[model samples]
Target: MNDNFENLFENSEYSKTIKKGQLIEASVIEITDDHAVLNAGLKSESFVGLNQFKNPGGEIEIEVGDSVKVVIEEIENGDGTTRLSRQKAKNETTWSNIIRAMNEDEIIEGHIQTRVKGGFTVLIDQINAFLPGSLVDVRPVRDTQYLEGTVSEFKIIKAERKTNNIVVSRKGALQGDSLENKSEIISKLTEGQIIEGIVKNLTDYGAFIDLGGLDGLLHITDIAWKKIKHPSEILSMADKVKVKIISIDREKFRVSLGLKQLDEDPWKKIISNYEIGNKIDCMISNITDYGLFVEIEEGIEGLVHVSEINWTNSNPNPYKIANIGDQVTVMILDIDNEKRRVSLGIKQCKDNPWDSFANNNNIGDKITGKIKSITDFGIFVELDGEIDGLIHISDISWNNEDNIDLSQYKKSDEIESSILAIEAKRQRISLGIKQLNKDVFMEFNQSNSKGSIVKGIISEVDEKNALVLIENEIKGILNISEVSRDKVEDMRTVFKQNDEIEAKIIGSDKKNRTLKLSIKAKEEKEEREAIDSYKADEKESISKTSLGELLKSKFKKD
Candidate 1:
């Protein structure tokens, strides 16, 4: 060997110890169109493909003196050249990262390259790993092509060196990051902080607002100062709204928001603007079976219960009287500040019809009305001012000792009656059709009480009893036994309809309007009178005979 060659070998890394399957640090010496020359502290420089030094962006990133890790494939090939592999060197490092991430539950970065069977191919460092479709995101993704060539963090769930198998979850890494970010966000939140955000989603009870990357709940009750049925009533999806933070729970990552807090609470000004008996014109926002909910102002409302809807009607139907969005005048009946409640009355806004009627009319005044309805107990007559007067069944007729056929009157039938009573506060008006004429019932009842002998005409006869008309208006019931002082098995044989018969008044029922008559009692009373008369006449005759006999004896002695 020459002196120059001997000195070169002594100073070169080739003599320092080089072997195949060994990783060593190398530096770029020169670059060409297709390849780069690297020096691994060896006597001879080796060539590497330029594509190996190119970054994922397809840009040539190599420069002179750039240190790289390369594995020796052969220290000396048949051509007497050093052979090294860059990809193999990177594979060893990639395995180390994957094993560490799996064992320590750490996150690693990867580039999603392409779609594969049942998953995507992720390049972690330089090693290929399987990323399942379900692991791409926190939620299911219909299209994963958008993730290609993008760098994302991942958690290695499984790894096997023998088969070179590795599995990673992007969702797991994202969830971990979300938890940390959520904690930071919640910790910084202060209650009552007004924030502008976009509405993310709406449910029946609330809406979820996106405060930057964090989500907060806006309950339906807090969405507006007025009552609402759902969150959608005031907000929609993706609507931009300013909300106030009502509450925050850092540990649970929960935040309560209120949209109405952005505006002045209308209830705070309610007392200043309204008081009991204050009449306000407003629109009916909602109508339920029980009441009408009217808006006093924006975000302020009052309830008018069915009872307060009218003054004359005992059971006023809310739906029948009003509808949603109807303009109406209501008087404030009560106010509850703490509960944010107001009791209202539709009838209080105007003069009560009952009171007006009472003031305008007097008892016994003649009234013309149309029958509004007929019930079992009474007939409702619609009188003046749409007010109704009840004509009870008992007051409907003066001659219904038998019965008054209610079918004679119908709805919208015009009739005349006299006002019997007026109870304004109780919301009742009593009328009597019989009062338009004389009350023969009262006179007949007074004149012929119990034990009074009265002549009556038989109006009806049945197997059990007979009906007889007294004073041509009142009728009394005469049982079969009362017809005669005998065991009468069949009342039909003893009496018939339209037959004239005299009887004594035995009993009376004012509620049922019945008078019991008895022919047997009348006959017994007549017999007693005749016996008393006969006894008085017989005693007078005896006294006269005794006086005549004494006078005749005294005349014979003279």
Candidate 2:
């Protein structure tokens, strides 16, 4: 009994020394409707509110004999017990662990609990730590929602022990890889090194190639020798391509790539297979204004110029002559391997007509022809064969002007002409019809003076004149004024055509082949005098007859 009393007095002294607001470890003894009795030694038994121990649904979170660390607030409330809180004790322990982690700059492993605007919340040991958006990935992640519930390594970027705040960086891990992996890939890449890569991203100028652990730029210009409008025309994302490294910068880890250099140049083998004057068949691959380009073989092209299609005819428009897919045979006239030019021709396959014409005909020969066509300058007359001649307007007639209408001479009019000139090289023949007739004026001028008299038949008559065909070839115009000098009012009354009359040449123009004739003055004067003499004789004879009759009658009466 003495030991029990000593123990009670000792406990009372310890409880008096333990003040309110002191932390104590206690076990829940009993749970009632509104309170839970907790045993905290040396202090009085603590009563925790049921609101703190029970969940909102009225179920007890802490059962009897469950040890809990709590804070005491009241010593007695008419029940010789103290008030305690378990939630406050748990909050203090959570804050103490978070503050220690922040001060040491330690990365605490956590699960992503939820997401925020710029980042996600990581539950690190029941403390929410901020993982920024930029620090979420080694590169960059567009959607943070994908990162929720995903575990990754990160570095602590911001930490404050006082505020218990922490921030982590995943980008720092990505930057560290650049310094370590970039040099390793570059040094192993040599010139002419063939490597496999994946097309990561496509751009207008180039593509970003991922060479396993490193990245290299693949420029669009190096994709192919042939023209490509865009990078997507040749490459696409995630496409596997084998590329040869042309150059490498070990310091910067830059690589230059070439796809075409792996193959042989097609032009090098093209020169040996063909030569000039080689008659080859080719397809018309392209049609241009100046020529048609033909592909004789793969990557080997030759040009057939517009002039070389047919030498006889001017180049027809390409649409009329050849289509896009037409196959043609062209003669190779020239080949220059160094210049990469092949000149071809179509006319070289046929015999030239001008060369054949030069061998057949000569000048000054008589050619019988029929008028085939007429132009402004001359008439085209075709001979028996394919031969034709031109009779210029000046060579048609000696007394005729070139302005004379030629429609009267229709096609198939037979005419004899002397071949004036023959240009066989030029494939031309010049003929003259007037040369077939004797030049009477030329002959007359050579034999006689300019004023010599000439006689001919009047062959043509007009309103005020007549044309005398002097010696069949030469002609002279008899104007109405020159035909009579007796004030002849009209031309038809005085002189009749085809009458056998003679006249002197008052004037002559040998070069012009013209003569002037007159008959009115002498013929009119002689006619008047003869008429007067006849009238006088008739009157005298009548008087004599009357006198004789009177004498005869008197003699009969005696």
Q: What is the C-alpha lDDT profile of model 2 across 1-558, one tens digit per residue?
A: 256754684578665676677777888888888888887774356667777765434667788889888876766657745677776666566556554433332334566768887788876545567887876766666666766876665544444446667666555444554556767778788999888898755556676676765667778877864445678888976799988888887776678787666676666765777777778888887888888888877656788898888745546566579987788988989988778778998777766554554455456667677898988778999864355779998888775454467787888889789878877556677898878887777676566454455566767666577777666365667777766664656556655677445444556665566776555433454567688888889989999999999999989997
The TM-score leader among the candidates is 1
Q: Write the residue-wise lDDT of candidate 1 on 360-410 in tens digits.
A: 999999989899999988899998778899999888877553478888888
- Where does candidate 1 stray beyond 4 Å? 1-178, 196-198, 229-242, 312-324, 400-402, 439-558
Residue 385 shift from truth in candidate 2, angstroms: 12
C-alpha lDDT (0 to 100) for residue 252 of candidate 2: 65
In candidate 1, what residue range of length 10 has the lowest lDDT sum? 97-106
Per-candidate clashes, comma-separated: 1, 0
RMSD of 1: 25.2
Name the 10 consecutive residues with the lowest summed lDDT in model 2: 99-108
Cα TM-score per model: 0.57, 0.44
Residue 245, model 2: lDDT of: 89
Error of 1 at 352 (Å): 1.7
Q: Candidate 2: deviation at residue 213, Å?
A: 11
